[model samples]
Target: MSDWEPKIVSFLCNWCSYGAADLAGVGRMQYPSNIRVIRIPCTGRMDPKFALTALREGADAVWVSG
Candidate 1:
């Protein structure tokens, strides 16, 4: 149980959240391995079906960042 971690599906904007995540990597910042990133052009491009698909595919949570 202690070893369990939430599996998250994150949809991030290419020039925003994704860039921050890339910068975090360069800065050696730590983020949870549970977060699975899917880069998108913009949050506006994100579809509701995407989140639903992620959930149906077994993700514990979904995050959208612009």
Candidate 2:
């Protein structure tokens, strides 16, 4: 079988969580490479439809950080 990596869709708040993610990148933190981040102005502005769409589009998981 072919190697498979989980596809994760992450919704991050522009204020804090996004910055944390940036730090993780700058620090060279080890994490699955399958995660894809989407920055939003705020968690309050997040819509359920976005997660649904990500799932429908074949994302193995969806995460939100704020």
Candidate 3:
């Protein structure tokens, strides 16, 4: 539908996972542009509802990193 990029939502832990992703970027790690990452204080804090809401809102994929 209209040159849409795949909507990928990633929930990452603030201390570890988020830092890793940032490192990946800084290292020039090429990845799909479809990803949209959201950093949380911790992966333990994520609720099921948050993932459901992402899909409900039209995300093609949702990933959680810890």
Candidate 4:
């Protein structure tokens, strides 16, 4: 059987969370490829419709980073 990777959408703040994610990549941290990153100015900038759209688009998980 083929291994299935779970899909995860991560919304990170441009100031800190995005930096952390970049560090994770630069540090060669091990993680599933299914995770997708979206950088935003801030967590409060997120609109409910965006999350709804993500869910409608078939994302297995949505992560909001502050």
Number of the predicted model whose lDDT against the real structure is largest:
1
**Candidate closest to the true structure, highest TM-score:** 1
Candidate 2 lDDT at 29 equals 94
Q: Write the per-residue lDDT of candidate 4 for residues 1-66, one digit (tens) a residue.
A: 277677888889998899988899999999778879999999989988888888889998888888
Q: Residue pairs in steric clash, candidate 2?
A: none
What is model 1's C-alpha RMSD? 0.8
Q: Candidate 3 — number of clashing residue pairs?
A: 0
RMSD to truth, every model: 0.8, 1.3, 1.8, 1.7
Model 1, 1-66: lDDT tens digits are: 998899999999999999999999999998779999999999999999999999999999999999
lDDT digits (tens) for residues 1-66 of candidate 2 = 379888999999999899998999899999778889999999997899999999999999999989
Model 3, TM vs. native: 0.87
Model 2 has an lDDT value of 0.92
Segments in model 4 whose C-alpha atoms lie over 4 Å from true places: none
State which candidate, 1 or 3, has the greater lDDT: 1
Flag regions of model 2 displaced more than 4 Å. none
Q: Which pairs of residues collide in candidate 1?
A: none
TM-score preference between candidates 2 and 3, better one: 2
Model-by-model lDDT, in order?
0.96, 0.92, 0.93, 0.87
CA lDDT, candidate 2, residue 15: 94
